[model samples]
Target: MRNWLKIVIFLSICLPLSGTADEKSGDHSKYVRHVEQGFSAIFRGDNQTAISEFETALAIEPDHSEILHYLGMAYAQEQFWNKAADSYQRSLALMPDNIEALYSLGVVYFKLDKWADAVPVLEQVVELSPHHARGQEMLGKTLLKLRRYGDAAPALMEALTLKPQAAGTYQELGTAYLNLKEYTKAIENFQKALAFGPGRYAEPHYGLGMAYLRLGDREKSRAEMQIYQQLQKEFAEYERLARLTRAEPNNLEAWSGLASLLMSQKNYPEAVQVFQRCIELAPNNANFHHGLSRTFMALNYPKHAAEAAEKAVQLMPDQSILYNTLGSAYAMQGKRREALVTFQKAIELDSEQPYYHLNVSKLYQSFGNQKLAQEHYRAYEHLLSEQKAKQK
Candidate 1:
C-alpha cells in the first residue's frame, strides 16, 4: 500500500501434495502402532514422524476413513495438496456427508483449478456448516475466477464482514469491480487491498491510471503513469529509456510535444535544434520533418525549411496537411513555382478544401497570373459556399 502495489496473488490452483517417509515396513498392527506413535510424536514436537506414521497407518488400513483423514491432514500440513486430496476423497467415499472430508476435498479441487468442482462442494459445506471462514473464502475465490462478479461480490462482502483484515477479500472485490468497469470502485478496493503489504503488485496502479485517463484528468493520469514507470524501472530491466531518448533527442514527450513546448517558450533556435534532431533521428518520420520545417520557418531559415518540408512530403506524400505546410515553407523561400505546385498538391489531396484554393489564388495573384488567380479565387468562394451549406 505504501508503494501503491495492491496485492500479492498466490496461485490458488495446483496445490502440490506432500508425501510421508519410511512408509509401511511391518504388519498392519505394526502400521497401526506407528500411526499411534506418529500422533504421539506430533504432540511431542516431531512432525516428520507424525507424517511418516500417518502414512504407515494408511498403508495398513487403506479403507479406514479415520486414518485416511489423518493421512490427508498430515499431507495438508506439509502443503502437499495432491496426496491430501486423494486421502480426503477416499475418506469421503468411505464416510459420505462427513463435513471435514467435504471441506478438504473442496480445498483440493480449489487447488486444482477445479473451480466448478470446488464451488458445489464448498456450497454444500457452507449449507451444513454455516459461519465457516475457509468455506466462504474458497467459494468466493472460485466464483471470482469464474467471472461471476455479481455473484462473487456478496460472498466476498460477507467474508470481509467476518474477517475485515483479510487482504485477499479486498483484492477479489477489486477484481470484481474491475470486471464490471466500475473503475472508481475498483480503485477504492485496490487501495484497500494494498493495506496488506507491498510485493510486486502492479495491477492496481495501472488500473488506476486507466481510470484517471478515462475520467479526463491528464495530470492524475500522468502521475499514475509516472508511478507505474518508476516501479517498473525499480523491479524490471527494460530498454525503453534509450529508445525514447533516441526517438525524441531531448524530450519530455514525443517530437510533436517537444515542438509545441519549445514553440510556446519562443526558444526558436533550441526548438529548431530539437526538431532537426528529431528529423535526423527518424529520417522517415513525416511529423518529425513537418515539425522541423515549421521550426525552421519560425527561425526564418528558409533553406532548412524547404529541405525539411520536402522530406515531409517524401515521407507522407498524400497528406493534405503536410502539403499545406510544404506550400507555406516554399512560399517563404520565394520559390513561387514550387509553392504553387505544393498548393496544387494540397488541392489534389482534398479538392473541396477552400484553404488550399485560397493559397493558390494568392500565389497566382502575386505572380501576376490574373486569369489563374481569378479562376482559383472563384474556386475558393465556391468551396466556402459548399462548406457553409454543409454547416447549415
Candidate 2:
C-alpha cells in the first residue's frame, strides 16, 4: 500500500498556547511551558517524553484542542493508535473544523486498516483543505482500498493535477480505472506510474496486464504480466535479503544480495545505500562496484555512475557486462567516442551477445554511419534469433 497515509508527527511549537476562552482552567503560563517541552520532545523523537509533557499540558488546559492534538501526535508516534484516535476525536469535538485533527484521525484509521472509518474523516480533510495535495491523495487511496473505483478516480485525478509526478497516486488511479473496466485510461495511468520507475510496485504492471487483456491485446498483456511476476520475485528476494542483512549486519553476501535485488526492483536510492554497505564490507569487490554503478545510472547521476563504472572496469577488466555498463554510463554523459570504444570492447569480449551488438548498432546510427549501423543491427538480429531458437 503506497505510503499514502503517513502522518508526520511534527508538533507546532510555534502555535500560541493561550488557553482557549472556553477552557476556564489552569495557569496559561504553565500550559504554554508544558506545550513547549512536549513539542521539543516530539522533535527529538522522544515519544514517551512528549506524551508525558502533553499530558501535563492537557491537565492544565483540559479542553485545549491544540494540546489534545499534540497529545494524539505523541500517541501516534508511539503507535498507540487507539489512544491517538481517541485524543484526535476529543480535539475534533472541541474544534469541529480542525483540518489537522481530522487528517490525523483519518491517518490513524488508515494505519489501523479501518478503511470504512477513514473515508468520512479524510473527506472532511479534503473539504476543509481543498488545495491540500496529500489530503486528496489519502482520500483517493482510501477510496481505492475500499474498491470504490468511481469515487476514487476523481479524487486521484485532483491529486495528480496537484502533484503530477506522484507515482503512488498514479498507481492507485490506474487500479481504479482497471476495476471500472476503463482499459485505455488504466493503461495510460499504469504506464505513467511505471515511467517513474517504480519497479517495486508489481500491482501497477498487473493492472496494466489486466487492462491490455480487456483491450484484447494478449501479447502485450502477457509481456506486462511477465514483468510483474519478475518484479514480484525480486521484491520478495529483497525482503528476505533485507531480513538477513538486519540479522547479520556484517554479512557481505547478505548486503550484496539485497543490493542486487533492490537494483532489479529499481529502488535505486535504497539500492545505492545497500551497495555502499557492501562496498564498505568488501571494498575491492567488482560486483558491488558494478551494482553501485547501475544504481547510480538508474538514479540519473551519470557523473557518479561513470565514476563507479570506471572503478568496476578497473576491478574486473575482463567482464564484458561491466564494459557494457561503462559504455552506457559514458553514453549518458554524452561521451560518444568513449561509449563507442567501450561498447566495441564489450562486443569483442562477447561477440554473440545481442545487447552488445544492439548498443553498438544504436551508437553507429546516432553518428549517421548507416552502413556500420546496418551491419551491427543484422548481427544483433542474428544473435537474438539464435538465442530464441535455442530456447525453443
Q: Tell me model 2's lDDT, rounded to 2 decimals.
A: 0.89
Off by over 4 Å in 2: 1-33, 45-48, 196-200, 263-268, 279-392
- Model 1 ranges off by over 4 Å: 1-32, 40-51, 76-80, 198-203, 210-222, 225-392
Q: What is the C-alpha RMSD of each candidate to the true structure, in Å?
A: 23.8, 12.9
At residue 284, give the lDDT of candidate 1: 82
**Against the true structure, whose TM-score is highest?**
2
In terms of lDDT, which candidate is strongest?
2
> TM-scores, in order shown?
0.46, 0.65
Candidate 1 residue pairs in backbone clash: 14-111, 16-80, 16-81, 17-80, 17-81, 17-82, 18-80
Candidate 2 clash pair list: none
User: What is candidate 1's lDDT per residue for 234-342, written digit by digit as tens?
Assistant: 4342235334556656563555555565666565776776777676666788987888888888889888888888888898889998898889888987888999998
The CA lDDT at 22 in model 2 is 33
